[model samples]
Target: MKPIFKRPRFGTTSTAFWAATIGLLLIIAAVAGWPNPVIFVMGAILLATGLLIWQEITAGLWIGLSVFGLLTVLHLTRAATYFQLRYLIYSLAFAQLGYECWRGLQRTRDGIDSEDIDDENGDGEEDKPMISLVLLQRQPKYLENMILTKVVESAWGGDYSNSDAQSDDDADDGDGFVVGESPMFVIKAPAGMFLVHNFDVPYWDNKDEVVEAIGELRLRNAVEEHTAWLSVDMLTPGDEEPDLNEAYLLVAKLLTALADEDTLAVVRPESLDLNVWSDDVVARLLTPGAYEELSLPDNAPVIPIADDAPEMRAAIATAQQRWPEFADAFQQRASHDKADDGPSFVVKAKITAGDSTEFIWVDVIGLEPKFVHGHLANDPVALGDLKLGSQVEFPIEDVCDWCYEKDDEPVGLFSLEAIRQIQEAQQTNEQ
Candidate 1:
């Protein structure tokens, strides 16, 4: 079954239809001797309201309502002299404006609740995919031009064309550029049109899951404090399943070209999955078969360190000093959820055998005043007999760093921060 694609209905067709209808009615009223100053004022106000609505501006409704109320009071008080027929026509036009206002509010509410609406075919399914790219910084000024240029260089180069003007009639105002409800650029492709919009941070329904995904991707700090995001939505031409592969490829290309280190994360809102921008990941996305195959693992592989540096030693000293606080929180969480598996707790400690010492993450099962009891979370490269998941006990003084999942977010990863700083320094030096 073909998935139903849904989006906001405000487009060029509706805008043009309303404009033409209003223009024709105003012309007829003027020809019929209803061209008084009051009539002209009402016509101008109506035209202004239409233009505001075309730009998807919500303030237009209040403006339209205030003018309608003012005109009604003037007509009743005999302060303004306009023909009765003209008044009736103006009243009907105001009624249409009121309806548009209500509809716009409904659309806004729906968007807040869910970006992708349920299938109208009554299947209780939404097969269409929508991807959002979360960014730590505002998009570059020439993003629209960059997107167009990249699309023209892709395999589907000639298969797409810019349609920003057709999708949004008031995209460019006459005097100065007026930003509408949101800054967006539209591209018409063979399968459908792609709507790319830059907006403020969205309300994620699966916020905890998203946080968990970010933690797994080792990008918690990068996106944890983001203020803005970009959404890429595919609008199918009709009731046909969109070319999913093409959409993925196009999005991948855009990510490769536009996403910098500051580009924090990418997420499929419908599934609440974080995606890494890499060639291997893109190849997996383009593979055929079940969608379940595309789901990334929750836990990322443990990153290795060849030798402890000054930063690592400092992090370890800090963790030792803060061990009391960690123990208090760990005990509290364990007491709170004792009936269930409880929160995930891990501690990084040094393991020594003969002359070699290695630091590894240990899955904490219990904690004592002087010791931490747990199993190794990862394989040791230097240690011969110490395998992954091997039960181990270590002195609390040897703990280098500690972390645990709290509400799906990783907290107290001190060593992780040091690692990030070291890597960043290396990159800076190379550049």
Candidate 2:
């Protein structure tokens, strides 16, 4: 697991107390001519705290801290006789700590706090709720008006009364106004208010490796060629029961109005996952209680509603029809052309035993004349002894779907898409 780092919030009275305590300890160590283990232990603790909890430690800081720690330990163990040299090193470490504390105090006085710190890990504990969209084309003129109109017409109905609109002519005229760079608008809804804005820079500007590592192939491809992006952040604060349902609906409508074939991807940054979007995807988004369901942890498995639904059959047919494309892509993978493209390339196929049949993901390891060979990516519900990572082979005709990451983008996900479509249709029929 990756180590999670967080910035320390300074400028508190406790910070002032620690600063004074360290200063007193340093003074005691310098006057006594004795190796102050307390000071050394404190130094080590501070360095560790700075590294793991505070600001991102630089290479220079790391080296300095490491040397200080090593020397302190050596001095404590009575392995060194260089008492003067040890005192000098201790003084330098104290100076560094004092400087950092002073900097923190200065920042606090300027109203800058821990919130200014970049939460790179995206654990979402400290961040606000937000939805972001990236597209391959710039949005149309009067984007705010378009979004508001769509939101009002959606399943979760709401209206935005724009105070900026002057006269009837201004509201009706085609030559109303040109949207400036990074235009922001407030949307007043039944749930609460939302802030929508277009960003000047694309969100995925320098994060190519992140996208690739996460297996968001579609999102990766979109970012590579994206021209525009926007964010919708919930503005109304809530204690317990926030209007998350309406917020999702608002995003759904926004996507309905703005998203097209050119739209790249929709993302909830807090969740740190790329949402797959289709025309029918909006229907799923608008369903009651979907927000809570989607907000579940990423590790949870998504069980399909049915194994033999029409959408499943349709997905299998589509994958078979597009089998040539998968074969060609596989051939590319076999060659050095697509080396190290992703972690795994797998296909979903049907497995049967007794009275049970289930579709399972299988990692692609080799190819045969009439069969695709690989290990099972998922444990079977019915098949015994054969567990996850077990070698499995299936004929080409039984393959329902295939997915591989190439060029930092996902290539095929027919069955996954079909499952979503199936869920969307079912929800719609129920309504």
Candidate 3:
């Protein structure tokens, strides 16, 4: 039997407090010349705490505190005479831990870097510009953490930022500077393309300060049709959300420059015209029953469904009589889906198209007409291209035998609007 492991529950603040307490006790015990076993246990507890709940600055502070506490205790007790060679070695270990903590602080300030590439569809090649691209930048503050801390707290996901306490206007106090919304633009002509450049706005402490920071960060750039991406440093501190209107205007000005091919030879851009696609055309393609009338079946059960369907047995029996050489083969295929209770039905028949007669398996599922309304199924390559998921009028002489079934119970699917309502209801229940 496999053993089940429950997730560990550790509150961030509580864990930090306990880790600091244990570290302090360990430092005191080591300095006070406590019993070997007692000092060893304290050291173990301190190590576990540091490993579990670690923040760079907090860990650094704890290490510094412990080192200073140990030094103070040694000075009080004549360290030269009272401390043995082993005790000196223990101090060196404490120094090492302190040094590691210092290194961690430096790493946190440096921040971390991450990169992801979007090659349009899952395909490797990047050719035409009809591809839509979006850039999402998650600031370093969110990602900078030790691997252990990240793994342990991954399930308890939350934004650990002062942004929550900050009012939108607080970041706006400086020189009316604001981080604007992500910019979106369309490049037409040579290739149809849509691009969204998401700019992260670091905390704007003051307008002049932010302006200087933006310059230092190299936030200014002309957007071109061929422009692949915009880069920002990990050290940049940005607001949670920026002003969209400003961002849109900034992109618009850049777009105008790109359109002027006379000056900029690389890009041959035109004015973005999105009104070309008519609402009616879009509705026809997306709205159920708008493009093609639905093909729904009546509730009437024309034949036994599933295993009870006589057509399956009849087809096999007839095949065996007509083609004795292939009787076993025919029976083998017919034996499938022989259950009395099932949503599917199996039928076999010889279909004639043009001059050729082909034997094929006819698999059918019970999809009530009401539930599958406004849907049409058609084969682009076949001669009878319009009969895929469309409504079928019953009593067709061509269909020698068919099993029919109606949906009397809910089958766990709904339209777009119905789905929205269900989601709202679920949210209400959760609340």
Candidate 4:
């Protein structure tokens, strides 16, 4: 058997290949009826061939059925005896199986042509940490951005936009703010990071001319009453020299004079070691007898409005008769006790004198009708040591009720007048 062994192959040409394959299948099928162990041997051969090339086996079977089907139809029409019904059925089955195998082979060989494309979220790059200081000192010739940056970084670990507008930016802000020592120690403050700057007042001759002291007093008052922080400061001698030594003395004097435990102010300048503010400056302004109504500061001009002096009662009545519009303005203001013991009026005057402009308010004050003094906006020249009455042309400040309180930040001068009226009415019986 080893000597006679041979490997069978398919085809010499395309037509011959098909014919041989068909012939080989036919021979294998009929070989089962032969003598010896031929049927078993053929079965073994078929199984072995199928195992070796299952795809080919199934394809051959399909083709055989297709041919059988075509041949069976013709054979039946012709009444052919070669067309046995059982053989025809077997042929059909084999042909179908062979066609299925061919289709499977084509599908596997062709493969599912596809391209793998992946976009990893196309996960974006990680976000960057915020910059703590972003000072935009546009055309900042004098003020250094670095100074603000360091100041911010040294104290608070936050962000900074501008030197003044922190919190808005993403920069480190110092934990505490440092108060300036001098003329800059004044300014009206509502909120407190306890900071201040940006002021241009008439240049000061005397230290009192600087507004820091007045600002501190207002701050102390606000703090006691509202428990709010006030960044009150005026212009200092120079931006360069913060001189905390002088600052310390002045602070001690100012605090000792203004100390009201209800209000507290802490100062921290880079001039101090470590720049930490721990101590309290005395609230010297809190001295009991020290509380004085904000009045016309001494040296304020005196504009008399009386025959002997100004008849405020008659003048007010006369004003109502003359400037009826102002009369309405006054009445709307004084709702509760507007009706006097008699008639009232509104008096108005327009004055243009020198560089300073002022609004002089008048009504009955004491026995004489004098200038109504409260918080009046005047150019430095207006508040003067005037010569006897140098024909001082006194006009009302253009305090159109709208721009009265530094433009409504504080109430208008009228509110103060209302308060005065209340005070006067309360004290009239005493007088």
> On a 0 to 100 scale, what is the lDDT of residue 347 in model 1?
91
Runs in model 2 deviating more than 4 A are: 1-161, 165-182, 214-216, 238-241, 292-431
lDDT of 1: 0.54
The lDDT of model 4 is 0.31
Per-residue lDDT of model 4, residues 34-103, tens digit only: 4445544444443443433332333443444344345446445433354323333334434443443454
Per-residue error (Å), model 3, residue 340: 16
Candidates in order have lDDT scores of 0.54, 0.54, 0.31, 0.31
Each prediction's TM-score versus the true structure: 0.37, 0.37, 0.17, 0.17
Candidate 1 deviation (Cα RMSD): 18.9
Worst 10 residues of 1 by lDDT: 172-181
| True lDDT of residue 343, candidate 1 | 71
Task: Name the better of 1 and 3 by TM-score.
Answer: 1
lDDT of 2 by residue, 270-386 (tens): 565454444334555567546444323222243545656888788889888988888877777678654455457789887766676667899888877799898888656446667
Model 1 residue runs over 4 Å out of place are 1-142, 159-182, 200-219, 243-246, 276-280, 289-295, 298-431
lDDT for model 3, please.
0.31
User: C-alpha displacement of 25 in model 4, angstroms?
Assistant: 99
Model 3, span 311-430: residue lDDT tens? 444544443343322223233433674433544332333344455433223443322322111112221112243333433322112233323233654221212233345446646997
